[model samples]
Target: MGAEYGQEGLVSTSCDIYSFGIMMMEVFTSKKPTDEMFTSDLSLSHWVSKALVNGVTQAMDSRLIRKDEENFFAEVNCVSSIFELALNCTAESPENRINIKDALAFLQKIRLEFLVKLSEN
Candidate 1:
Protein backbone atom coordinates (compact mmCIF):
# COMPACT_ATOMS: atom_id res chain seq x y z
CA MET A 1 0.00 0.00 0.00
CA GLY A 2 3.03 2.27 0.13
CA ALA A 3 4.36 4.24 -2.79
CA GLU A 4 7.85 3.55 -4.09
CA TYR A 5 10.42 6.30 -4.50
CA GLY A 6 13.19 4.52 -6.40
CA GLN A 7 15.50 1.53 -6.13
CA GLU A 8 15.22 1.57 -2.33
CA GLY A 9 11.59 2.53 -2.34
CA LEU A 10 10.70 3.93 1.12
CA VAL A 11 12.88 4.10 4.16
CA SER A 12 11.48 4.65 7.64
CA THR A 13 14.65 6.43 8.83
CA SER A 14 14.31 9.27 6.37
CA CYS A 15 10.65 9.67 7.25
CA ASP A 16 11.56 9.92 10.92
CA ILE A 17 14.24 12.52 10.15
CA TYR A 18 11.73 14.68 8.31
CA SER A 19 9.18 14.23 11.07
CA PHE A 20 11.67 15.25 13.76
CA GLY A 21 12.44 18.42 11.85
CA ILE A 22 8.74 19.23 11.50
CA MET A 23 8.13 18.59 15.19
CA MET A 24 10.94 20.93 16.22
CA MET A 25 9.59 23.66 13.98
CA GLU A 26 6.15 23.18 15.55
CA VAL A 27 7.51 23.44 19.08
CA PHE A 28 9.48 26.58 18.26
CA THR A 29 6.69 28.34 16.38
CA SER A 30 3.72 26.71 18.06
CA LYS A 31 2.05 26.31 14.67
CA LYS A 32 0.36 23.27 13.20
CA PRO A 33 1.88 21.90 9.96
CA THR A 34 -1.25 20.95 8.11
CA ASP A 35 -1.12 21.26 4.30
CA GLU A 36 -4.07 23.67 4.40
CA MET A 37 -1.83 26.43 5.84
CA PHE A 38 0.71 25.50 3.23
CA THR A 39 -1.39 25.94 0.14
CA SER A 40 0.29 27.41 -2.95
CA ASP A 41 3.66 26.04 -1.88
CA LEU A 42 3.60 28.28 1.18
CA SER A 43 4.43 26.03 4.05
CA LEU A 44 5.03 26.62 7.76
CA SER A 45 8.71 26.13 6.97
CA HIS A 46 8.50 28.79 4.30
CA TRP A 47 6.88 31.31 6.60
CA VAL A 48 9.37 30.66 9.35
CA SER A 49 12.30 31.08 6.96
CA LYS A 50 10.91 34.33 5.62
CA ALA A 51 10.20 35.58 9.09
CA LEU A 52 13.67 34.73 10.31
CA VAL A 53 15.16 36.69 7.47
CA ASN A 54 12.90 39.66 8.10
CA GLY A 55 12.66 39.68 11.90
CA VAL A 56 12.08 37.21 14.69
CA THR A 57 9.32 39.34 16.20
CA GLN A 58 7.35 39.02 12.97
CA ALA A 59 7.68 35.22 13.08
CA MET A 60 6.38 34.92 16.64
CA ASP A 61 2.69 34.40 17.36
CA SER A 62 1.14 37.62 18.65
CA ARG A 63 -0.53 35.67 21.47
CA LEU A 64 2.89 34.96 23.01
CA ILE A 65 3.81 38.63 23.30
CA ARG A 66 3.73 40.25 26.69
CA LYS A 67 2.91 43.76 27.82
CA ASP A 68 6.39 44.44 29.23
CA GLU A 69 8.56 41.90 27.53
CA GLU A 70 12.23 42.29 28.37
CA ASN A 71 14.00 39.26 26.93
CA PHE A 72 11.72 38.93 23.92
CA PHE A 73 14.36 39.89 21.37
CA ALA A 74 16.98 37.59 22.83
CA GLU A 75 14.56 34.69 22.94
CA VAL A 76 13.61 35.29 19.33
CA ASN A 77 17.24 35.15 18.25
CA CYS A 78 17.72 31.89 20.10
CA VAL A 79 14.68 30.37 18.48
CA SER A 80 15.80 31.59 15.06
CA SER A 81 18.94 29.45 15.19
CA ILE A 82 16.83 26.45 16.12
CA PHE A 83 14.51 27.22 13.22
CA GLU A 84 17.46 27.24 10.84
CA LEU A 85 18.46 23.77 11.98
CA ALA A 86 14.95 22.49 11.43
CA LEU A 87 14.92 23.96 7.96
CA ASN A 88 18.12 22.15 7.08
CA CYS A 89 16.72 18.82 8.27
CA THR A 90 13.60 19.36 6.20
CA ALA A 91 15.52 20.14 3.07
CA GLU A 92 14.04 19.06 -0.27
CA SER A 93 16.65 16.38 -0.92
CA PRO A 94 17.24 13.60 1.54
CA GLU A 95 20.95 13.68 0.76
CA ASN A 96 20.96 17.34 1.77
CA ARG A 97 19.43 16.60 5.16
CA ILE A 98 20.65 15.52 8.55
CA ASN A 99 19.15 12.56 10.40
CA ILE A 100 17.05 12.69 13.58
CA LYS A 101 19.97 11.73 15.82
CA ASP A 102 22.05 14.62 14.54
CA ALA A 103 19.14 17.02 14.85
CA LEU A 104 18.60 16.00 18.48
CA ALA A 105 22.27 16.50 19.26
CA PHE A 106 22.22 19.96 17.76
CA LEU A 107 19.11 20.87 19.71
CA GLN A 108 20.67 19.68 22.92
CA LYS A 109 23.68 21.90 22.30
CA ILE A 110 21.44 24.89 21.78
CA ARG A 111 19.52 24.07 24.93
CA LEU A 112 22.70 23.78 26.92
CA GLU A 113 23.89 27.14 25.66
CA PHE A 114 20.55 28.71 26.48
CA LEU A 115 20.72 27.27 29.98
CA VAL A 116 24.21 28.61 30.51
CA LYS A 117 23.08 32.05 29.49
CA LEU A 118 20.10 31.84 31.81
CA SER A 119 22.33 30.84 34.71
CA GLU A 120 24.62 33.76 34.00
CA ASN A 121 21.70 36.19 34.08
Candidate 2:
Protein backbone atom coordinates (compact mmCIF):
# COMPACT_ATOMS: atom_id res chain seq x y z
CA MET A 1 0.00 0.00 0.00
CA GLY A 2 0.89 3.64 -0.40
CA ALA A 3 -0.14 7.16 0.60
CA GLU A 4 -3.34 6.44 -1.22
CA TYR A 5 -4.07 3.80 1.37
CA GLY A 6 -4.21 6.55 3.93
CA GLN A 7 -6.17 8.78 1.61
CA GLU A 8 -8.62 6.50 -0.15
CA GLY A 9 -8.30 3.30 1.88
CA LEU A 10 -7.99 1.21 -1.25
CA VAL A 11 -5.28 -0.91 -2.82
CA SER A 12 -4.41 -0.11 -6.44
CA THR A 13 -1.69 -0.41 -9.05
CA SER A 14 -0.61 3.09 -8.13
CA CYS A 15 -0.43 1.93 -4.57
CA ASP A 16 1.81 -0.93 -5.74
CA ILE A 17 4.10 1.62 -7.34
CA TYR A 18 4.20 3.48 -4.08
CA SER A 19 5.06 0.31 -2.24
CA PHE A 20 7.79 -0.48 -4.76
CA GLY A 21 9.25 2.96 -4.24
CA ILE A 22 9.21 2.46 -0.50
CA MET A 23 10.96 -0.89 -0.81
CA MET A 24 13.54 0.68 -3.09
CA MET A 25 14.20 3.38 -0.49
CA GLU A 26 14.42 0.81 2.27
CA VAL A 27 16.87 -1.31 0.29
CA PHE A 28 19.19 1.61 -0.31
CA THR A 29 18.82 3.31 3.08
CA SER A 30 18.71 0.12 5.14
CA LYS A 31 15.98 1.62 7.29
CA LYS A 32 12.53 0.37 8.16
CA PRO A 33 9.41 2.48 8.09
CA THR A 34 8.88 1.66 11.77
CA ASP A 35 12.43 2.40 12.81
CA GLU A 36 12.69 4.12 16.17
CA MET A 37 13.95 7.31 14.54
CA PHE A 38 10.93 7.44 12.23
CA THR A 39 8.40 8.34 14.89
CA SER A 40 5.97 11.27 15.04
CA ASP A 41 5.50 11.81 11.31
CA LEU A 42 9.12 11.26 10.42
CA SER A 43 8.57 8.39 8.05
CA LEU A 44 11.40 6.63 6.22
CA SER A 45 10.82 8.62 3.04
CA HIS A 46 10.58 11.91 4.93
CA TRP A 47 13.81 11.22 6.78
CA VAL A 48 15.60 10.26 3.56
CA SER A 49 14.30 13.42 1.89
CA LYS A 50 15.64 15.53 4.74
CA ALA A 51 19.02 13.80 4.85
CA LEU A 52 19.39 14.04 1.07
CA VAL A 53 19.35 17.83 1.38
CA ASN A 54 22.82 17.48 2.89
CA GLY A 55 24.12 14.81 0.49
CA VAL A 56 23.33 11.41 -0.94
CA THR A 57 25.98 9.97 1.37
CA GLN A 58 23.90 10.97 4.39
CA ALA A 59 20.79 9.27 3.00
CA MET A 60 22.26 5.93 1.94
CA ASP A 61 23.12 2.89 4.02
CA SER A 62 26.51 3.10 5.70
CA ARG A 63 27.63 -0.17 4.17
CA LEU A 64 26.83 1.18 0.72
CA ILE A 65 28.59 4.50 1.30
CA ARG A 66 32.03 3.23 0.14
CA LYS A 67 33.62 6.64 0.60
CA ASP A 68 37.07 5.14 0.12
CA GLU A 69 36.26 3.32 -3.09
CA GLU A 70 37.52 4.60 -6.44
CA ASN A 71 33.96 4.97 -7.76
CA PHE A 72 32.46 6.28 -4.53
CA PHE A 73 31.05 9.49 -5.98
CA ALA A 74 29.79 7.69 -9.04
CA GLU A 75 28.03 5.13 -6.87
CA VAL A 76 26.50 7.85 -4.75
CA ASN A 77 25.30 9.73 -7.79
CA CYS A 78 23.67 6.59 -9.12
CA VAL A 79 21.96 5.97 -5.82
CA SER A 80 20.83 9.56 -5.62
CA SER A 81 19.27 9.36 -9.04
CA ILE A 82 17.45 6.22 -8.00
CA PHE A 83 16.21 8.00 -4.92
CA GLU A 84 14.84 10.71 -7.11
CA LEU A 85 12.80 8.09 -8.95
CA ALA A 86 11.60 6.62 -5.67
CA LEU A 87 10.46 10.03 -4.53
CA ASN A 88 8.66 10.53 -7.80
CA CYS A 89 6.96 7.20 -7.42
CA THR A 90 5.98 7.78 -3.82
CA ALA A 91 4.40 11.13 -4.40
CA GLU A 92 1.48 11.74 -2.05
CA SER A 93 -0.82 11.97 -5.03
CA PRO A 94 -0.91 8.86 -7.21
CA GLU A 95 -1.88 10.92 -10.23
CA ASN A 96 1.26 12.96 -9.83
CA ARG A 97 3.59 9.97 -9.78
CA ILE A 98 5.84 8.82 -12.59
CA ASN A 99 4.23 6.03 -14.52
CA ILE A 100 5.84 2.57 -14.70
CA LYS A 101 7.02 3.12 -18.24
CA ASP A 102 8.69 6.42 -17.45
CA ALA A 103 10.17 5.06 -14.29
CA LEU A 104 11.78 2.19 -16.19
CA ALA A 105 13.14 4.56 -18.79
CA PHE A 106 14.53 6.78 -16.06
CA LEU A 107 16.17 3.80 -14.40
CA GLN A 108 17.73 2.67 -17.62
CA LYS A 109 19.14 6.11 -18.18
CA ILE A 110 20.52 6.22 -14.67
CA ARG A 111 22.21 2.87 -15.17
CA LEU A 112 23.71 3.96 -18.43
CA GLU A 113 25.03 7.14 -16.87
CA PHE A 114 26.53 5.24 -14.00
CA LEU A 115 28.29 2.85 -16.33
CA VAL A 116 29.69 5.72 -18.33
CA LYS A 117 30.93 7.39 -15.18
CA LEU A 118 32.47 4.15 -14.02
CA SER A 119 34.30 3.78 -17.31
CA GLU A 120 35.82 7.21 -16.84
CA ASN A 121 37.63 6.09 -13.74
Question: What lDDT score belongs to each candidate, Candidate 1 first?
Answer: 0.71, 0.87
User: Per-residue lDDT for 1-121 in model 2, tens only?
Assistant: 6866887798888898888899899999998788898888788888778767888778799998677899989999999998889888888888988888998999999999999999999
Top lDDT: which candidate number? 2
> Best TM-score goes to which candidate?
2
Tens-place lDDT per residue, model 1, 6-114, is: 5457766666666777787777667877746777678877888898889866766666655366665556657877888888777766777887778878888878877
Residue pairs in collision within model 1:
none
Cα TM-score of candidate 2: 0.93
Give candidate 2's error at residue 79 in angstroms: 0.7
Candidate 1 TM-score versus the reference:
0.76
Native-to-model Cα distance after best TM-score fit, residue 93 in candidate 1, in Å: 0.6
Clash pairs, model 2 backbone:
none
Give the runs in model 2 whose Cα sits over 4 Å from its true position: none
Q: What is the lDDT of residue 58 in candidate 1?
A: 70
